[model samples]
Target: MRSYHLSHSGAGLAGLTVRTHDAPVPGPGQALVAVRATSLSHRELLVLEGSYVLPVKPDVVPVSDGAGEVVALGPGVEGPAVGDRVMATLFGVEHLAQRGGSLDGMLTELAVVDADSLVPVPAHLSYEEAATLPCVAVTAWNALTGDAAGVRPGDTVVVQGSGGVSLFALGFAKALGARVIATTGGPGKAVRLRGLGADEVIDYRATPDWAAEVRRLTSGRGADRVVDVAGILHDSVRAVALAGTIACVGFVGRTAEPLDPRALFASGATVRAVAVGSRAQFTAMNEVIAEHGLRPVIDRVFPFEDAPGAYAYYAGGTSFGKVVIQGAGSPAGIG
Candidate 1:
């Protein structure tokens, strides 16, 4: 089996080591999946930067999101028979602990995972699209429909940036009948976002106080939900409606200053730090995807041999959507 393994080389994406190792055999209660495609996540970049909750494990496969077909089953594995298309659930059911932080992830040609951790891919999506879901898509779904009074029909959602989660949030929120307002650091990306259903697009660079623009767009009431992917909590608080919710999904921007407690308290908004979601949440998100026939936006699909290129591309911060790496055995007709 060919796999991309992580090491502490500090050479960035080029530091990863790809080797043709022996294929791993699944153990009891596990299934062997031939990965069709895998997508990059912020967590993997954090691992490379030594900033993740857990340090990068030497020689460990290093991606959290992927889709594949079951090829073999170990002893006692009863379900997900060989040939079932599946994607691994990144969140462990208990405590919502991350799956890839400790265990070998889905960067290899063949992955052996607990049978229970696998979920059926939405029938309408391709393996490439399914590869983008285990993390970003689920996080967006959870942000829109979390335990808090999430964005409902006729509500307005403010999604920051043009990353995977933001774009997915735009799609899902619109599917739920909510209006979506998007923000991006890049100029000229608004048209692309608007094409993807963003009711309004603000270039944060062009409009430094984009949150105020969000309020103005909402007719001064503020957005009912804010998907804060840029760590701009201070501005997010300013942009949200009273008693609204802000889903703090990521901090890619790292440009925001410290937030004042008084501002947050004044808004009466529930600021949730989304840790992806649970297995049940993932299942529910897939159901909605199937129902809406929603397709994940893919910025690029690098081949397995160019896994390093995929990581580099994702790290470039230019992609408007998920950066994926197609597996060596993936077929063009993934659906």
Candidate 2:
């Protein structure tokens, strides 16, 4: 089998290389999945760069979001049947506790997942579409409704950037009957976000203080929830919300700016920091995606062998949604 592994020198996409390796049989309680397609996000770059909590050793497999079919099962495994399409969880074993840096196991041509960690892809989606859901989708789901918080119909929600997480957040929020206010640095992305059910799209580049614009749009009450993908924009996120709920998920903005703690007190707001969620949350999110017939926003697709090129493109910020790599020669349902 062929796999893309990280080089020892650095975490850049250049460190990712394709190599051939023996395809091993599954062990006890495990299932061998033939990967159909996989997707990319900033997290892949973090793992390659050795910044992820569960840092990969040199030559470790290099992606997390992938979908495929179960080809073989190990002893005691009765979870998925052969020919069943499935997606692997990042922490193939961690079902509960927040998987920190220790859960680094999902990117490969044929991943051996535990029976408990794999979930069936929603019926309405293709393998490529299912491949894009696990991490970003679950994270967005967790950020928005994980706690079973109140996000009533017609309530306003703000999403920063149209990247994977924020885009999924926008869709999920809309599905719950909340109006979404999306922010984008790119011109076309604002239009695209609006088309994705965002009631308003703010160009943050044109209005750097987009939080104020958000307040203006909301008649100074701010939004009910703000998906803060740009970690540095914490203050701005706080600035625009009505009374509570700021979900901080990404750190696209590199700067660590100071924020006024008093703002939260004044606004009576709640800030929640979310990482990619658990298998349980992934399962729940899948149900919602299935019920709503939601399709993941795909920015581009590259050949599996071109994984490095895909990573480079992801780093270059040229894509509007998820960047994917199709498994070379793999069938739609057979990994």
Candidate 3:
């Protein structure tokens, strides 16, 4: 099987190398998948830079999100049978399972995954779209619907950035019937975000105190649910309404300043950290996506042979959506 591994010969973007390895065979209770598509995540970049919070193997396959057809099943497996289109992540069963990080990921032509880790792909989505869900989409869903932040119709949601989790939050919040306030630093993303159902868009670069704007947009009540992808917890405290919830999804800003205790105490809001969700949440998210015909936005897709290019492109900081890699021999734009 052909795979992309974290290379030892270089650093940064140059560290991804395409190589051939023997195809994996399924073990008992496992399924062998012919991976058809994969997508990149911000953590993958951190892994390459040796800065990821979780430990990653030097040679692990480089992506956590993939969708494919099951080619074979091991002795104990029953369903998601051979030929079924499925999506998977190590996060499926064990929240701590880290495929594409500590374990071999799906940046290969074949992946032998735990049978129970697979889920049927939403019938309405193509492989490329399905590939974008396991990480970002699930995390976004958990942020909005999690216990602390049960986003409701007529509630206001603040999502930061035009990246996968933020964009998915925008769509999910809209589908959940909440008004969405999206924040992005890129000059070109505001219009695209408004088109995607963001009730209002703010450029964090132009308005450093964007949380005040979020409060202004909500007529001073502040946001009812804030998905903190931008990693500014103090700002989230200032932006959330009294008794509102803040889900800390990521810190794309790279620096997580200590939160001010005074501000946190003043907000009277709950703060929770959100990791990628469980299989049950993924299933529910897929059901909602299917009901709403939600499409995962793809900013760019690279052919499988160009995995190195794909990784580099995603790290370029210009993508406004998910970056995907088509499976070997698969048609481009499979979505």
lDDT of 1 by residue, 1-335 (tens): 89888765243565688889888899999999999999997877887676777544566678889999999999998778999999998854345445556667888999988899999999988999999999888899999997657667999999988888888999999999999899987656888998999888999888999989998998899999999988889999999999889899989878888999999999999999987887788998888888998999988999999888888888888888999999996886468
Judging by lDDT against the true structure, name the best candidate: 3
Tens-digit lDDT track for model 2 on 1-335?
A: 88766664255666666778799798999888988889987777777666665544555666778888899999999779998989887665744321112332445677777767789999988888888987888889888886556677888988888789998999999999998888888788888887888898889889988888888899888888887878854565455564568878878787858767776677777778888787788998889898999999888888887777788889888788899888878665322
The order of the candidates by lDDT, greatest first, is: 3, 1, 2
Residue pairs that clash (backbone atoms under 3 angstroms), model 1: none
TM-scores of all predicted structures: 0.95, 0.92, 0.95
Residue 230 local lDDT, model 3? 73
State, as a TM-score between 0 and 1, how close model 2 is to the true structure: 0.92
Candidate scoring better on lDDT of 1 and 2: 1
Off by over 4 Å in 2: 95-107, 148-150, 240-242, 332-335
lDDT of 2: 0.78
